[model samples]
Target: PRLREELKKNYWIVDNGYNSFPTQIPGEGGEMLCDDEIGDNIIGVLFAAQDTTATVMTWVVKYLHDEPKLLECVKV
Candidate 1:
């Protein structure tokens, strides 16, 4: 319900005369997306973002450990 309201109130839709789609911002004359599709897309984006961040952080920590001088500088 809240998501639906948000979609309805989206700035692009309300201010720019853009049509709302279920999962994405469709181009002109595109069809609206369903709620489920939007939800799935949101979930996928969240997971992908989280995984990327985690992987980057893991590499950073590994590199920092390998370079004690850099790690000490960062600690300060």
Candidate 2:
């Protein structure tokens, strides 16, 4: 896939956990991740992020329902 190729061509820079350190980190098995693994990880991260955002928003709305002044301030 194009994403895999781009990650490979860019030295697997996206999720290898070495962006600032400038080193190559291995996957769970001490090897570079295959294309499928990268895609799966991407999906996992997306789902996790969305779930977190939804939880935060739910809590915010719940609290807002209890505080009319804060909710009105937020609308402005």
Candidate 3:
């Protein structure tokens, strides 16, 4: 919620009242995200999660490095 204005574009609203990225449901005939919109949002979310994922992985490696037995078990 506190992301700087410059970084705000990194996140996207799937659909709001404006429906800037409008799409439609195939059979139901309702507004929804199309393939491109889905892909765009997914990419945004994944990129945003990168730092968090890397931090967790770094912690995991640090823990395993401190515990040889645990690391060996994980390798198997």
Evaluate all candidate structures by whole-model CA lDDT and list the values in order: 0.56, 0.55, 0.49
Over 4 Å off, model 3: 1-48
Model 3 RMSD in Å is 14.0
- The true-structure Cα RMSD of candidate 1 reads 15.0
| The candidate that achieves the highest lDDT relative to the unseen native structure | 1
Clashes of each: 1, 0, 0
Residue ranges of candidate 2 with Cα displaced over 4 Å: 1-48
Flag the better candidate by lDDT, 2 or 3: 2
TM-score of each: 0.36, 0.36, 0.36
For model 2, name the residue pairs that clash.
none
| Cα RMSD to the true fold for all candidates | 15.0, 14.2, 14.0
Q: Which residue runs does candidate 1 get wrong by more than 4 Å? A: 1-48
What TM-score does structure 1 among the candidates reach?
0.36
Residues 1-76, candidate 1: write the lDDT tens digits.
Answer: 5554555567556365342333444433454566466546545655777754454455557768999997897799
- The TM-score measured for candidate 2 stands at 0.36
Residue 70 CA displacement from its true place in model 3, Å: 0.7
Model 2 backbone overlap count? 0
lDDT of 1: 0.56
